[model samples]
Target: MAAKKASGSGSKAAKTTRAIAIDAPPLDAWSDLIGHDRLIAGLSAAIQQGRLGGSLLFVGPSGVGKTSAAVLLTQTLLCERSSPEQMAPCNTCPACVQVRAGTHPDFIQVSKPDDKTLIPLELLIGPVDARLQEGFCHDVHLRPMQAKRKVAILHDADFLNEEGANCLLKTLEEPPANALIILIGSSEQRQLPTIRSRCQVLRFQAPTGEHGRQLLRKQLQWSATEDDELQVDSVSDEALDAAIELSAGDMHVAIRLVRGGGDKIREALWNQLDAPVPDPVAIARLINGHLDSISKDVPKRRAALRDVFSIAVQHYRRQLRNDAKSGEYDPATHRRLDRTLRTFREIDRSANLGTLVDCYAADLTLATTGDRGAIG
Candidate 1:
């Protein structure tokens, strides 16, 4: 493959950042990747020393390549010929090619079952002593077909709830020697503190606008106007004003209101002059304010956060399905959309009107639009 540059123009502030993809050499240059040198360097060193731990946690937000890094590390470890200074896999090599195609016999991807979201208790943790007397290997240590070390990659480590996390604790603490358990997660804090302390953690952050765009462009092949390759499109003045209020500088959240059913709320509010519509963000603010007041009024803040997240997710989903065009939506918006949906799904695993309306005004604001008068 050819080498490629990572992001857009890097600001001086970015030098201190831990964004992904930035350090990786693009396939174009395939050698001079700009940002990820620190992480790459560390992992390279670990693999060389053969001191890499059996259990590892790769933490950070989406799209940055915790998964990609795991894949690369797998490549490096499995490569037959290794120079003293170079631990990266030569992608053109047969081992690299097989790993890239995911046909490698030794690599096993352990994740939540397709039908179930969380890694099941029985699957991760073995049965109690009496029941498990037969000495069978745990699901993870079942051994690879041929490679020296069996690799088990767990993506979305954060999705494992308390029960799920606990189940893996025993295995994580005493991983099999033949096993390499690599976990891909968004953040250290997102997991239990006890779990956080056990394994070595690698943190990744959002790419700079430039590098982010490069990855987006190369992989997504998206076509749009951009500032230095950061393909940001300005919504109409009305949408901008609303998004600006709701999202602050988090463009990901702002874009959702534009591409998704966010326009529905806009369209609904444009009737007679006597009325007005609220933007989705505004609706969030209005409802959030009330929820805040109630939380302040009451002694605690239980369930409110979850409630807001669930309600907002429902709203975003409506927008997603309503406005989906050829399976496209702003990346940021889509992320927010997923967040809300997942939150609701979990809440529905247990856990809506006017005062209740204030409860959902922020979502309504996003959904409704255009009416200039007042909250409708």
Candidate 2:
């Protein structure tokens, strides 16, 4: 009877694992997309009118669902059984499944090289000696292999250098009849004017308030199902509210805050900051340790740090405002707060974070202790 019970438990475990795999969200999960209703309607109208542009640009702040929209567009274009009226792809169709699996012959995705700072010229066009039959510039002109139309998504368009942008311009100026190109970037200014001029731009904004809360709750619930540590249903409204505010409506940041040991690390960091004589090295090391524990990949680590830094800045900014209104405004304190906010721009740069954090901690200590000469 004991052996029989053991076998039954094993069978139940396998069944549960299978259920999770089957229920995993599809690539074109429309319900998963939030806070871009107007943008979705416009894109849907383009599909219904059969006026989808050859080259499209999606510009917005990070984590605002630009790429998700692009993927949904790709599905609508490639699905074997989707109609214009539905404006959504049938996720089960062979073509849709292939697109979701990222194995569709008609779809291409290009992004910045992990080892390099910018998108290389060869990656956009072809190698100089073999430009005729190589790279996205050449492949894009070819007819679709499976779907009715071909789609090419260029991610991290902000990383395009002059040569890369120039190479992409020729294709942008005169794309093939069957090709659709989508470029995703954080802002329009990041791309060359020549590249920007040739594309139809779509803007995405972050979700706010109740809409933001609903999105956060859905995401956390899904995460809890996937990861055992997350207790989405039991988490208090206050904690969820704090996460939402800290994220500033960025979906990616909110998700990371819930799953990336954010609460624990944040509390510890703040505790150290509130110390009578906070040690800069100790605080920097705390952040560095959490970052190291999260990921070995540079980009992921940088993103996690950005979220943490943003939270810290938000906390101090509130205090600054309160102090100002009470006629206790200190110039040094304001300067330090401004500098911390500015550090958000340097996450993608080559600056030394240890030194940066050391300076930030020193500034905080001076501002609170009224020792303006500490930094000097």
Candidate 3:
């Protein structure tokens, strides 16, 4: 059968502009990984004992290094100088170097495009004209050119549509010899039962408290090393603490707060919410401007708005705490928090961002003014 070229130029999500860009450490730089010490140790032992399964599922919060850990494991499996018993990658070897560079022949990684809501079917199997002739499923079965094993990492497994998941079932059912398939998702509950049942599940927790602080510190150090203008000493402890609290243990959010002027945005949001009248129109404009500054892409804007909602939730929760300390209850504050949360969840499902923002702002106004009306 002759293969036909895929039609149209493929689409991609717009690149988000960050105040300071922080790249994940190279795959072979295992020491750079944070907050999964026990998981890593257990995996290393499993590798040494030859008990590691061919198909594995890593379920965890976003930005917690699940994908990074998968890449490191791939490096270990393919490293030229390391035996399985050693479970370590010699970063200097050809295999390790290629894996670190993302040029290794036996390593395959696929994730949902930022613009799209799900992992497209064509990514798993081949495009319509060449089913199984190309893409990840076909590539995973090919003979390894350098390493003894082929490793395929499917990221964003949470976004796999029914068709895509079904296409992957056969490969999961009978994987090629010496091949490893790893799926990374937010949670096992987000996965289809058939898909989850086929793989060994490893759960990961979001780093919190001291672990969260350490992660942020490490990121700052990395940023300092990469950009001569950035000095770790310049960032105040107060800023770090604020970022940690706002981020709630998600490193990606923490990074944005510390490096992306998110702290200032949060402060602005708080000030607006604290206004005597709490103008919904003004609040909506402030948030819309912040979202626009993040990206023109709707998905990115929606995500940023969700973060804004999180900040508002925190603000009201603090008010509630203060109310408790003063031996008084403010129903308005409690209602405002509830409305903010509802709007946050709606960000994903609502198509019209402007309307969502407008409604959200009005709801907050109503909640704050103690108006007896439908909120959000």
Candidate 4:
């Protein structure tokens, strides 16, 4: 197969350097993949028995191994040396190397661009003028050049809008005999019914218990050897435990807490909430300050604000549990928890960040102080 050309105007060496800089670390071997043992076992068995389906929908929380799993499956299918029954890729082979480098002739991947909220229609089908001359739908139909089959993994499947989904329906319904299509999204509920119905759904849960601890350590670069005790120097054992407890089994959340100084933010939030009379202005300022420190990008700040809300939710829940254990029902605590959850949901829909934060803080304060007037 010929080497893939880099897009845009540049010398070959410059384009190659740009591509290498942006590429994520490749999952070269199954050992490089962490967590989801049971899912891997089932998928491996299906591949070995030749029972794997043509289309698959992977639904899970963000930062889980769905994309990595897709890449691994592609390697297993397109490996030059591994037999179908073996289901193992020789990572050094040309086919495996190309796949890892994301330059494989038979492999295709697409996602919603960072600047755009939805997967554009043109990405699924060609632009109006060219029709099916380009894009994922067009490319997936081509004959495989290297491997016996072609594989296309579409990331951010949650962002596929109605028009884009419709463009993909015919392909999903009558997929090419030699092609595999995989869609990765956060949850099945986020996907449209029509799209979900046409593919095999695989639900992935966040790692928990020992699995969560191990994966957290691995991501943090804190894990030493399999037999050695977990090293703790920069991050204390208590901080690690707190991060694990608050992360809700998501590795990304855990890392953010330990590395991003999210723990400090969490503490500040708790301090504000636990005050005798919580100050809405102070609370809003605290949260906004934390958001600003984390990112200058609006979308990223919005996402981090959601995480802050999640932390508040946990705090109220913990208080409610404490009240329950003490044989005292605090209606105010219950209302605050419910309102915090509602505010959390609203973050995605609301555009005015300043207004949203101020209203949420004011509403939480009112709930705490037994005031009847709470903003929706």
Candidate 5:
């Protein structure tokens, strides 16, 4: 059985991230990558100067380009340079080709187990950790193995519980000059202070609905031919809208929602217009649709909804914490966001679903419309 985990929006929705496309072009091919332009530029500059930190923490909402950006940076760092302006791979090169195929000598990717479980102490030691810390470590010590830098990427980095985190921390604290570690966590604060302290943090945000829509179109280019009534443009709007909403400002979430039977949200809508089952305008209605629409006769629906809210709360809290770092959303929005979250916390503890949902949703809508942030 696949490990079921709660996603960032706090939804326990299942995710189906296919094996990365080998033929996909490396970093530089992604120039106008909608949101997080600043992050790209910063990473670009650091690599160009050879000024990148040994250990980096890529933290942000779930879907923004944290993992993708890390992949790109690795490509740039190893690329034989034509110019400093671009540090990622020139995909045509030999090394770049291997990376695209996921067979590069000096690169490794680490994630959780099949149980959708956290990284246990043992897995992090002998097989996964030793391979990177010792084997790859020794190789990179001499010189770049085809590529200039030896790279290790840890995804869902927050899953490294106390023992696992401790092991990685030891390596990160005094990393070899030949090594570069990228830790991609769902949220900044969610990462342990011990881990967060050692690495330079780079934040990623969810790409806009407009940007995500374009990506989906390009990938799933199913045009309406002479024989078919179905068209790519027609199907995409609903998919994109659901993606954007489900992601809750995380690109990863948006993409996942599109994949894991998330397209169901589109069909769930018309019935929801008056009844408001799937797409609830109010918080209570959303909760009702989410938890009540369950038919598999299991706890999956409720658990998934719980997970979604957890992630959403975490994101809202993050916005409030670093008010200065992110200027796009002002302080007022942060305060409003905070109030909404506090209400969520209150609801999370309650057993009575109906009252809790109704109260929280009404409160948030009221807060959003007012200047002083009062829940009417």
Candidate 6:
């Protein structure tokens, strides 16, 4: 492995601000990795067997506890005290407290800067303009300050540009002793082949069925075992179920959906779905207005729009699936629906939300009636 400089240099001031000295929260417990019992067991067994390696890659959807796993694994590795067999951290220890408070000297976490599109190389290897500064690459090579092991969680591995990835290759390939490097991303394919080959990859899947519902209940803090006890005038078990279905197994998304007027949003979506031709612009404007009324942040509004599109996609998919089951599926209509779904999936934050919504509605209208203008 060779050392190289990552591309797209940042200004000295930018570099200083780009790297956030985060004091990440310590894992509540390894049990918090809900819906992943088998993976947890395997990892615990690996710790017991002393087979844990330096470089581990966790790949999964956005909200599936990949980072949480990284934090827990760090605790297991660096805990001042733990069980002889299972390697569970003793939460009462100073090491555990520091790790929990994100103030651990040996534990470092880095992520893509929210203001930038890509993780700058300067952030990984230190600023290009500086000669004697510690970035992730240089810092990881140093001995631990407080613990026997040093753990670094690279949160936005996918955002690492070619240069940044190359710069970190040597460190990743030949990590320093008593150091653990964890790379997290949405999928294995998003990572460079070089990065993927060097690390032990752990794939995480979405919790579904009973696992999903249980997690939702836990997250929502609903303790009612009986259905009647769970029901409130505004939010109920049915609403929770609807959020779970809409979220498509993504718990973060489900939580967001539930918090952001789950029942009302679902009702509005279904109403639009039943229309002869759903008016996407009107729906988009309505959603935008609602989100703006609550908060002025554009990202918040964009997320709301994405949720709306996701619901639309779910509705069309159900229609297509039902048609197929009944032997009434039309190939042309099916193709159209598939295209509409693709359009929704592809809508990004870069696109104008209102226009994107209009385009989606038009596409659906065209798919159903061959008249794109019908929805407008």
> Which candidate achieves the best TM-score against the true structure?
4
The digit string of per-residue lDDT tens for model 6 on 140-203 reads 7666667887888888798887878888788889998789999998789879999999898988
Off by over 4 Å in 2: 1-32, 221-227, 264-286, 289-300, 316-338, 341-345, 350-356, 359-376
Q: Which ten residues in a row have the lowest lDDT in candidate 6?
A: 1-10
How far residue 211's Cα lies from its native spot in candidate 6, in Å, is 2.8
Tens digit of lDDT per residue, candidate 4, span 119-226? 877777666775655677877776777799989888879888788988888888778999999999888987889999898888888876666666666666632336
lDDT of 3 by residue, 1-376 (tens): 1222221111110011001111355544556667777887888788878888889999986667786788788888888998756766888899887776666767777777666768888777767876766677777776665789988888879888788899999899889987999999888987999999899998878776667666677766654545555555677767777776776556666666676678778989999999755898899889988987899987677767767877887888888989899999978788888877677435543547898788778877777433324323
TM-score of every model versus the real structure? 0.54, 0.75, 0.77, 0.80, 0.60, 0.78
Superposed model 5: Cα runs more than 4 Å off: 1-28, 80-85, 127-144, 215-232, 236-242, 256-376
Candidate 5 C-alpha lDDT tens digits along 232-344: 56665776766566556654445444544554543442233223122335445645665666534334543445444544455455545576576455554454456545543
Winner on lDDT between 2 and 5 is 2
- Candidate 1 segments exceeding 4 Å error: 1-34, 81-85, 92-94, 125-139, 142-144, 222-359, 362-376
Score each candidate by Cα lDDT. Answer: 0.50, 0.70, 0.74, 0.73, 0.55, 0.68
Candidate order by TM-score, highest to lowest?
Answer: 4, 6, 3, 2, 5, 1
lDDT of 4 at 217: 64
Model 1, CA-based lDDT: 0.50
lDDT tens digits, residue span 97-190, model 2: 7667666777777776557778777665555664534566766766666777888888889888787888888888888989999999888987
After superposing candidate 3, which stretches have Cα over 4 Å from the reference? Answer: 1-23, 27-31, 221-230, 271-279, 292-303, 316-352, 363-376
Query: Clashing pairs in model 2?
Result: none
* Full-model lDDT, candidate 4: 0.73
Winner on TM-score between 5 and 6 is: 6
- Model 5 gets an lDDT of 0.55
Report RMSD (Å) for each prediction in the order shown: 16.3, 11.9, 6.4, 6.3, 11.1, 6.6
